[model samples]
Target: MNRSGKAVIVLLILLAAASISLSGVIYYNLEKEKSQTNNLSVEISDIESEKARLEEKIDEQKTELSKVYARLEQNEKKFKKLTFSIDEEKRKSQEVVSESASLRKDLADTKTAKVDLERKITQNQEELDSFKLEIAQLKKVKDVLQAKLKELTGDFDVELGKIVIGPEDASSKSSPRIDATKKKSAASNLEGKILVVNKEYDFAVINLGARDGVSVGDMLSIYHKGNYVGDIVIERVDEMMSSANFLSSNTKEKVKEGDKVVYRSS
Candidate 1:
């Protein structure tokens, strides 16, 4: 309780006050740190929940991706099969095209052969018709010759007793006798015009016939403007028309329609 004791007491009172203030500050700082630690813990918990949700969504996406990959593999297999089928179709189409071309060529060849065969048949038919016509004409000539032979035999029977055999008479009997028709045709002065001239067939149709003193095998001269063009031998005769064949040796020019034909003896 003297002066020095009073000073130490005052210093102890200040120290005590400072210690009280520092304790209060430390308590306030520890409470603030505790509040901050609780807030951080709550934030960490929320982060963990969000991370779990994201992981689950990622699993779903992986499953969907696997399904997509499976579908893509199936489509690739189908495309490969379709490509092989398309190649086969193209090859078959080419083969069909080649076969069709070959068939068309064969058909064309067959058509050509058929045309040639038809032409040959037509030619043969024309020749056969000509032969039939010649046979008919020969039959008529035979009838006429048979009738003349009958008449001559009847005449020979009537003159057989009066006939005498002599050397000069024997020669005369052996000589060939001329038909009356030939003699008449040779002396005939019949004149007529040609109606048709077929140069390809080498024949002519004349206006003269049997009625005009024209007979079969009678030679006639064809004249154009008083000049001899050719000669024709009568082959077939009608009442007003006659068909004659051209004499190749006597043809000086091509005969034409309306040319004059005069009978002449050969």
Candidate 2:
């Protein structure tokens, strides 16, 4: 009971102390490992969430890029169409300009032609006026020459004697006796009368006839109370009557049934 019991009690106390120390060290290590594991799990979860967000962003960027590409293609097409329309419009404008130039040239040519034609017409009109004046002068000269011939021919005296005395003066009882020399003198100085004026036939009937020397183609004059009325040509003749046609006349002065007939001495 003495030494061996004391030694056994000491050994028991030492074993209990050793056991308590080992348990405390083991519990502290376990708590530290658990904390490290929780931290690692939280970090992994955060990395997974960040990776999903990055993938969604990448998809959205791809969609936007696709829209941009489509817009660029549409713009290119619009540009090409606009270029074609501009070229067509330019071609049409050039054509219009060319047509306008051609029309202007034609208008200028027409104006020049009109001016030339007007000038020619004026010159022609002047020439025609000159011709008319020349004709008038020639007519006056002809009339003068005709008057001179009538005076020289002595034809008017022969017509005068026939008009004054009726034809057949050689055998009529009522006929006046006329000497040959006196008859010649009377032929030079006789005036006459118109027995009938036939307007429908444009002729005058006179008492003078063939026997008194009246013949066809003889010219006679008509008068009304000493005023000259007209001129006539003998168309027909008989022994006691003759008819003459009015050659040139103005009938403003009336030639009635009893108007006087005469012969102009040139």
- Summarize candidate 2's per-residue lDDT along 1-266 as a digit string, tens digits: 79866655555555445445544544453454344445545554554455455455546555555655555455556556645665677665766656545555555554555555455545545554554444444343334334433442343344333432222332232223346566544543455567656554477777665435666887777777777777878899754457788875465236765677665567
lDDT of 1 by residue, 25-126 (tens): 445534543454455455545545554555555465556556545554554555555456556676666666565555555555555555554555455456
Model 1 error, position 195 (Å): 0.3
Least accurate stretch of 10 residues (summed lDDT) in model 1?
Answer: 167-176
lDDT of 2: 0.55
- List TM-score per model, in order: 0.32, 0.31
Query: Model 1 off-target regions past 4 Å?
Result: 1-187, 249-253
Candidate 2 segments whose C-alpha is farther than 4 A from its true place? 87-266
